[model samples]
Target: MRSLSLLLFTFLCTCVPAQTIAQTVDTLMEYTAPSATITAYGNEPGIGTAAPVALLQQEELTRYDKSSLLSGLNRVPGVRFEERATASYRIAIRGASLRAPFGVRNTQVYWNGIPFGEPGGDVPLSFLDAVNTDRVQIIKGPSGGFYGPGTAGTLLMNTESIHQEGLFKLAPRYANASITTGSYGFLRADATIQRTKEAGTYNQFRIGYQRTDGYRDHSGMDRLTLQYTSTFRGQKSGAKTALHALYTKLDYELPGGLNPEQYADNPRQARPGSADKNASIHYHNLLLGLTDERSLGSWKLESALYTTGFYFDHPFNFDYKREANLGAGGRFALRRLLRDDLALALGVESRLQYRNGQNFTNPDGTRPGDLNFSDEIFSRQGLAFGQLTYTPGAWDFHLGLSSSQLDYSVDRTFSAEGVTGETEFTANRPVSVRLAAGRTFDFGYLYLSRTDGFSPPTLDEFRTNEGGLNVDLDPEIGTNYEVGFSTSVAGKFFPSISVFHFALDEAITSFSDDRGTQLFRNAGKTRQQGIELAASWRAISTTDKAIGLSFYTSYTYYNFTYLELERGGTDFSGQDIPGAVPHTLNVEVGIDLRNGLRLDLFHNYTDAIPLNDANDVFADSFHLLRAKLSYPFKSFNVFVAGANLLDQRMSFGNDLNPQFGRRYFQPAPGRNWQVGMSWTAAPKR
Candidate 1:
């Protein structure tokens, strides 16, 4: 009890002053300028648009590291992070599956305006470092129109750019560094450097490294990343370029399922004589972008063009895989403010992507073996969208519409010792539309309506010779609906609530045939509904003593039932879909002390999920607790964190990836602690 009191006291002292000062200054600076200045081509509200839709500013992101940033973004309801290992994570939104070996399906991840996914629409989260991001946006449901056609969800991450304001003014400007250690052998370090000037030109660089000796045996990882952004401005146009690169080497022990006896006695023990696997992945991405703004009569024209390239390589278990992607896109927008009450924006965009890759398998456990399979694919898309806003008295109304078309083609070949053949090239075309509406009232309250479309399968679903497998899959479609309200109370408290439902059709499923080879099939209907609530407040405010509190919680209910199934040439009904957790809860709270000190608490709970169609294997419910404390000074920062405070063991999947067991596959680590410090000195002004 004494320790708890002290912890709370410390938190209150750190945050109060900052909160009070910010509020006072913001209130005093609420005066409006002479006229409303608006830019076209900007899709969403800018820095200080609506009270609820305001973009998070730069200061809000400074204290966060990669993992915390990802975890703290719970604003998007029904999004969950699947911990693959210490440094590897998969983001699952609204019950979307993350088990595809080739890559993640149904989700699209983007950095800046460029895609961070494989050409075939697989997003690998291991390549991104959240610590370096300036802002993160999550678009839920089947809103793939902004990216491509197949994704059901989109994660957009924006990194710091060189053209930002207030970067180069201070002599020997400000800088900071952070280090963290937790469960397993988790260790992470992040640092940033920036240079800004009054000429509208700036340069920023971020570097990060992470390593972990995983909870399970034979699971370990090392990851390194570097990113840079630079911008140059001319009279009416600007050129912005970003470079990002990452290298990850993972030596993970695979945990095959255990029999009944082994499970009951010791779940964390490793199976005997299992093969040790080493996997290495290299990712490189570069983006070059240009933006131009000009005026024609009373209207403004905004345009942007971007080109990006990504490459990947993996070598493991006598197999070598490699892939490369090149993509380019351009967007043009027209914007105008009509009278004093209306604003309009219209934009058109087109993107083209090409991918080439090959997978080779051999008995020698080395490269240059027999070419087992190879694939080459091409994808192209175009989109047109428009948004209009009208402000009349206390009511603010917004409307948006977008349409898209996608075309994809794939060529595949499979070669075995005796059987060698090429599958006929396949092509697919998918189209989609989206609509959204929202209204803001006088009391800082808002209501919204939205619908987004998602495209299903492509050539990868039908090519038999593509990867030594046969897939006769059909496209799956998704429709999502959402409603929400948000407002702040007492000028010091902020809160929001939202509810959403998603419906999926022709969902993809995989099953093994009599020959033991797996095949893909389109399954039945699945639905997910959930609610989210979050609040933040300044608990204590004063000149000499400061304190603050923030809390966020969310709950989700997901249900999946097989509408149709075929078993051994016979129909089987009334089976629960595997890997669907019915319920999930997440909560977080944090406090700041006056003397540059901070403390945070977090919790997560997930209900049981089915292992297989028969419900034979079940992953039980589990809870996790974590805490962190940090102190900052003029030149350096130090922090400590503890994870799995309760030593809870939970598994996400039934047999495929059973978490922390008596054997070597323990997914979560036992209680552990770590502390580290770093110092930074910025360049002279």
Candidate 2:
């Protein structure tokens, strides 16, 4: 790949003059809140609630961890990341496409508040592990409809909390580790532990493990994860409380494909002993939460409650399934600012869900063996919302209103040799409505904006895939438009630009016949538009002279068209719209070398896609490069890194699952390396 694109353009030209002098002294000591703010009304932390874009820091995601989260958020700007192998991965904004694997519809995922897809809205990025995240909020279009209702384009992952004057106070916190051997036997591990004190409380923990023996042929993978957080405080109604937990394990190896001369003699071959193909998966998750805040003189109240659980054992193709889930949700808010530029918010939300399953078949049948049959399901939802904000000066305004309700039910049974059957149902009143807008301006110092939104759909969209039978499908609507601009210039430098348009209506599709079973249909319209650009600079700073420079780049153009389709009875509209991807690009550069040496570089590009929709397999355009180096003594700190260097060979499938060719699958880890260190201890007032 042209020496991995000339060693990532010579490591971003030697780290762009020390990341433009440390982003002009870190934007003059950072801290600049209040630019048309919102954060669910005064719960600080980058102020939330809506109308605030551009916030993705943690040193721009320390070169990513956890098998890379969409290659570090696709370097921002209308993001895009879609990989079906390597434990599957997906993300698309402005032009969504997860190529359906039974889920991923219109993007919608939330962790801190539970509900992370799967009930047909597929969202399974190996269940997260971007070094245990602390921030990642990108809500564009349809104003993310308050976190529910088929997210018109959303990606919100915030985790990292545990405070209480540092609890058992024990300072000296810092540790780092990494070991990667890429290409076809990929392996990874990550670790973190933190503590803080100043009467604000704190504690954070994270651990991750990964394995890969894939490059094709029955692919391979094994994974593990763990996380914990805690916090507590109370002093004159300034109360606070939080607790969180997570656990995971996964195993994989399923290679099913042949014919065409056994895939041109070894696309990394693995067939012959196809014992009913192969597949095995197991998963488990649990979460509990509670939060509260109080104030009177100026009116402020916040409340939250949550409980969630999930278990799974999925054996594909030859069928062998067992699933379980339990859920609970709650939210309440009240805020007031009426005097300072006007502001008001009132909210209510509720959620409940349960599901059970079983499926087995093989006894003389052509695969998918054992267990017989069973099923169960139940669901509920309710929401009431109100919001208003105004600024007067720069014409900053926002308004919102919502009313929602949904209910569902299902049951079934069946036994083979002895013969038995039964099924039941229920579904009712699913409704939705939401809206949003924004505006800002300031020529010289640069800062401009324009926004819009919409979202609707629920009640699992009229059930029927083997439960609560009722396929009267209707629901699923979205609309969004945007325009943006930002600047900083002299204070070192920063730049931004954005443009978008998206549309979806009654869109839900699934197909599988000829006795393969799997059906669900509803299609009519789908659309996506895009544009995004970003920049950051500093060059160098003095205080003993510190060098710095940061860079960012983005590009995305996608289109998925298929106005309508209804087989058998004949009806097909425009066509073209199966895993759409016209172009994608990302660039990164970082350097702080002034003694404690540090350097980072990255590059990625993807174009050409269409392995299905009868577009006849196609996948071209590829580039990747990475590097990292770090050093810091005293408390202990050391590092080294490399990836792909230049071993490009990529291929992804989607037309009825056709993953073949380019033997490396996603191979690029050819130049492997890693080293670790960390030690800290300080707690004595």
- Which 10-residue window of candidate 1 scores lowest in summed lDDT? 31-40
| Native-referenced Cα lDDT, model 1 | 0.54
TM-score of 2: 0.31
Q: Tens digit of lDDT per residue, candidate 2, span 481-575?
A: 55566667786667766665556666655444333334445566766666667676765643446776666666666656666655557455565
Q: What are the per-residue Cα lDDT tens digits for candidate 1 across 123-191?
A: 656666655566666655665254455535666666654322232332223344556666667777666
Q: Model 1 reaches what TM-score against the true structure?
A: 0.79
Worst 10 contiguous positions by lDDT, candidate 2 = 660-669
The CA lDDT of each predicted structure is 0.54, 0.54
